[model samples]
Target: MKKDLVKIIEDALKTLGIEKPTHIEIEIPQNESFGDMATPVAMILAATLKKPPKKIAEELVNAIKDKSVFEKIDIAGPGFINFTFSKKYIYSEIKKLMKDKSKFLREDIGKGKRVQIEFISANPTGPLHLGHGRGAATGAALSNLLEAAGYKVDREYYINDAGKQVRILGLSVFARYQQLLGRDYPFPEEGYRGGYIEEIARVLIKEEGEKYLKRAFDEVSDFFTDYSYKRMLSSIDSDLKDFGIAFDTWQSEKELYKKGDVEKALDDLKNRGLIYEKDGAAWFKSTAFGDDKDRVIIKQDGEYTYFTSDIAYHRQKVEKKYDEIIDIWGADHHGYITRVKAVIEAIGYPKEKLKILLVQMVTLLRGRKPVQMSKRAGKFITLREVIDEVGTDTTKFIFLTRRPDSHLEFDLEAAKAQSSENPVFYVQYANARINSIFAHAREKGIDTDMLYNADLKLLSVHEELRIIRKLLTYPMIFEGAVNAHEPHRITFYLQELSGMFHPYYNKYRVITEKSEQSRARLALCEAIRIVLQDGLEILGISIPEKM
Candidate 1:
């Protein structure tokens, strides 16, 4: 419907020999008396065309070729044009929606473009924290939204397996294992001190049983490192899967070093003159591509920095022929973005081809007070613990209620409430109410499915029309979320749509279907259910028929 109106406006501009603006902004007026849709295209053109906005608006209105569908067209304050559709036209459009909803639901904006997103690739040294869970939720939902918008999206997890942290993890577990075997070995000062370390040590004792116990620590370091990290990575994968997320690929940083990708990437940069030797260390000229300073890729000790492997991994991702790449990282990695983007430009890809989103910190709350529970596993709470306390659905929904870059205060008690204060509960209760209405209609011997094809003209009340108009805004919400790469927008819409529904259901009684008016209103309720189910599913949430 917006496209149809924009076409009419464009035709008028063409007929009057006036240049059209690049974009025509159309919105639903807050004041229902103004019109169904309002635009300021004339005022926009007035600034560029050097004419009075009122005069331009009148000229465009006079030249309009078709006004048959409009009840009236009026120029309001400061050259804003308002359009009110005729009743016949509005009903005809709703009828079209009933018969062909796919046409009204979404457009194929991506046109077969491929997108690759890597997120929540937590270090294998420890358990996943709440921040990682937030990234997982955001990435999964964003992937769904892009796919719904017709983009082929692949999700990935990049493992930071080749790092000092894993070495620390190995030493941490080795000390615990020695202590369990009655040997006195000093633990690393910066080692992981969690109870899970003891668990891993016990597992090793049950398997190896003192076979490698007498060997030097140096001889068994690699075995301990590989075993500990793989165990933690398995735990991370299980938690994510239980939380309703699964990645298409698991990329290993260790593989990059083994395959000589780091050397290949450095050689490519050296040929481009972006690699320079400075003070006995090899430095990357990142400033040539907008980084604030050059960075050292290799130390004087002949060891590669973390940045070297990062560059190689991203280069491999680009070589996969994806149209775009998205990386989600913790907010602490903010400074790394510029250098990584510089690497993209240095490798002949545009900086815009790579996008990064940051996940901020999360604070847990119980009721109105703060939650400060310590697990024996880690100092901070684990994502698994949260999911265990609250159900998976509550945990996921609360995680997505804020933007990726915004700090979130998740209240475990509030999320589990059955009251209106709980956003998920409020929205899902409306879905349950709708289903209950259908069930009642069926009990009265009314064919509930037939209501889907009911005459929408019977829905003439103001509240009914308002609900219909709100329903029409869903596709707009979906498109906006896809463009902004924010899944929280869907949560906001869910609250607003449910707020509209509960009040309407309270004031009106359905299943009085002796009159077709009741059937029409019941059909409107079904339409609301359709949208709620779709929105929740796209966010990887389940719908409850009863709550």
Candidate 2:
């Protein structure tokens, strides 16, 4: 629709003896009364053509005819051209939607490029908290959006299995095991103290018995560290699965280290003069590539830092030949983005190929009161608890309601609400209501097959035209969501689309009088329902047949 409008304007300019401008902006008007779409092309071309804005707009509008798609064009609000489409043209689009509903909503903007999005790489030291859940939902929705835009997407979770954090987790479990056996032990101050550590300790006690616990403190800690890391990772995986997030790959940091990729990446950096020896340690010259300062790759103890393993992991991703790599990290890691991109650039890869998306924290709220979460103090809300309180669909939808970069204040009552106040329920209700139209049609013995073949020209009602206009915007919405790599746009689009449908439903009758026009309206209702279902499916939300 936007393309057709642009071509019409371009043709009008050529006829008016005006050269095409460099660019033009077309956007939906904030005030629906303005028109369906408003363009500032004439205002932009005024300076180039040496004419006043209004003069240019008037001439352009006169040159453009309302022959095909456009019903009329008017210049309003400081030389902005507002476009209103003919009801017949919109009804034709609705027919197109019904004939090919599945493919109508998708755009080929990605051109089948391979993209890998790594997200929710939470450390295996503890269960996933609410923050991790937000990242998981965002990443999953992003992958679905990219695929819907015709890109091959790979979802991944990078596990920090080999780190000081895992060591602390192991020691925490060992201390709990000793306490469970009624032995005196002092747990390290820096170790994990979450209640989940006791669960891991119980599993260790059940599997290996007292003989394993009788070993020296250091030896048992080493054994428990390896066992507990795997156990915690498995538990995290299961929890995410319950939340409807499944990763195509679970790349382990420890596996990368064992494969010697970390050392190899460091050597490659050294060969490229990107690494240097400093203070008996190795550091990468990250500052040269726009980082705040050089980053340490190897410490004085001859152990690689987390940055070293991350460089290797990124290199491995590039070696896999992905057209783009998107890393979704928590907001606290925002400062780490520059260095990671610098490393990718230093490794002979384009910096644009690696995109780091930082997702802000989700602040859980009960009405106006904030719910505090702290991992170190063992005061936090687990993802499982959120999922249990609200179903996975509601949780995912609420998480995706806001942009990832914006902090979200999740209201528990709003999410679990069964009324129209909940955005998720409101959107699902639109689908249910559309299904009700079909049920009414069947009950009245009105055959819908005749409507599919009905002359779409019969659908010229103002309410029906409004629904068709909303449906026509799907492709543009999809393209924007894909280009921005933001799935929250789809959530917003779904809400707005549902709002348009509900009012239309209240104004018009789908099975009134059981005439041919009624059948046509019922067919339109079916098309709307299917498109809503498809949109909800992309967001991983269910369309309840009866809400």
CA-lDDT, candidates in order: 0.85, 0.85
lDDT string, candidate 2, 65-84, tens digits: 65578777788988899998
Question: On a 0 to 1 TM-score scale, where does candidate 2 land against the true structure?
Answer: 0.95
Which parts of model 1 are misplaced by more than 4 Å? 365-377, 413-420
How far is 522's C-alpha from truth in model 2 (Å)? 1.4
TM-score of every candidate relative to the true structure:
0.94, 0.95
Q: Write the per-residue lDDT of candidate 1 for residues 1-547, one digit (tens) a residue.
A: 6878889999999998987888888877888888888899999999889999989999989998779989899999999999988777776666565555655666577778999999999999888877788888889999988888889999999999997888889988989999899888887778888878889989999998987675677899999999999988998899998989989999999999999998899999999999999899999999998899999999999888999999999889888989989998888899999999999999999989899989897888788788775533357778898888777777778877888888888876776663345678788888999999888887887766766578778888777787777777777777778889888888888888899998888887876745687788887888788778778977888799997
CA-RMSD of model 1: 2.4
Clashes by residue pair, model 2: none
lDDT of 1 at 326: 95
Clashes of each: 0, 0
Kindly report which residue pairs in candidate 1 clash with one another. Answer: none
